[model samples]
Target: MTSKYEIRLNSKIDIRRIYTNETLPLRKKVLKPFLTEEECINPGDDLTSTYHFGLFQENKLISISTFIQEGHPDFLSTFPYRLRGMATDTEFQGQGLGGILLQHGVEYLRQKECDFLWFNARIKAFPFYEKLGFSYYGPLFDIKDIGPHKVMYKILIPK
Candidate 1:
């Protein structure tokens, strides 16, 4: 049996454009608690072409990801977007909120004619990204203070 509270929360999930500052709390809590607030900020976070997205359940921000107009040297696409700092609250981790938010961002980029989307996905997250159609692009590498990661990419067929 579902309670009224559960119904309300399930019915009110929303994904929308958010400011960079709005993503810091979840990112810090879920992705990098060891880093300071300043270190949680990604490069290009303030750029005009950069966008931040958040998923909210009844106004509580639970999932976040940032997209920036950055290209990889190995990829030949003219317009490539990089996904950064994707995180979801611990309580909401397995509910597919992150996938929902990512798909929303992909649709937005497709509308904007982005050629491809890519990111350095953490080792433990490979299966999640793979299930979403992202392919591994490079060999494993490690970021300082962070664990292993691999470049993953998805080609966007423009809508």
Candidate 2:
């Protein structure tokens, strides 16, 4: 069962605090092989970016996600598209936090009238993207210093 965590659209949360939470050890472990220690996007980066959201459990960050407005074709931020960062406390896995975060991201982007929401999902996590209705696109690309990442996108329901 999932604990009570309120997911909201907050652009001011400190990214570092959320990204480094000890509860999400598995998240860190899973993403570690795919991203360098310095390359991981922290909460501060999200707060500073154009669009992002945080999940809180009684004022403490429990999960988080974000997207940046890409002017050209950056992987994380592509021109009004959202590059999603998702994390849940390791203890909270399998309880639906990811799904909640995913839904929240989509809804927030949809409200903003984003043309598309996309991200380079980890190959192992492709099923999660499928469940969210995101279609795989293009050939898989290794994340340079990280593991292979599959580009995925989903059209948002027009507002």
Could you tell me the TM-score of candidate 2? 0.67
Among residues 3 or more apart in sequence or in different chains, the pairs in candidate 2 whose N, CA or C atoms overlap within 3 Å are 15-43, 15-44, 24-90, 70-77, 70-79
lDDT of model 2 at residue 128? 74
lDDT of 1 by residue, 27-81 (tens): 8898889988788998899998998888889789999989999999998997899
**Tens-digit per-residue lDDT, 74-126, candidate 2:** 43333356564566666666766667766766776677677667777888778
RMSD (CA, angstroms), candidate 1:
5.2
* True-vs-predicted CA distance for residue 153, candidate 1, Å: 0.2
The top-ranked prediction according to TM-score is 1
TM-score of each: 0.92, 0.67
Which candidate number would show the highest lDDT if scored against the true structure?
Answer: 1
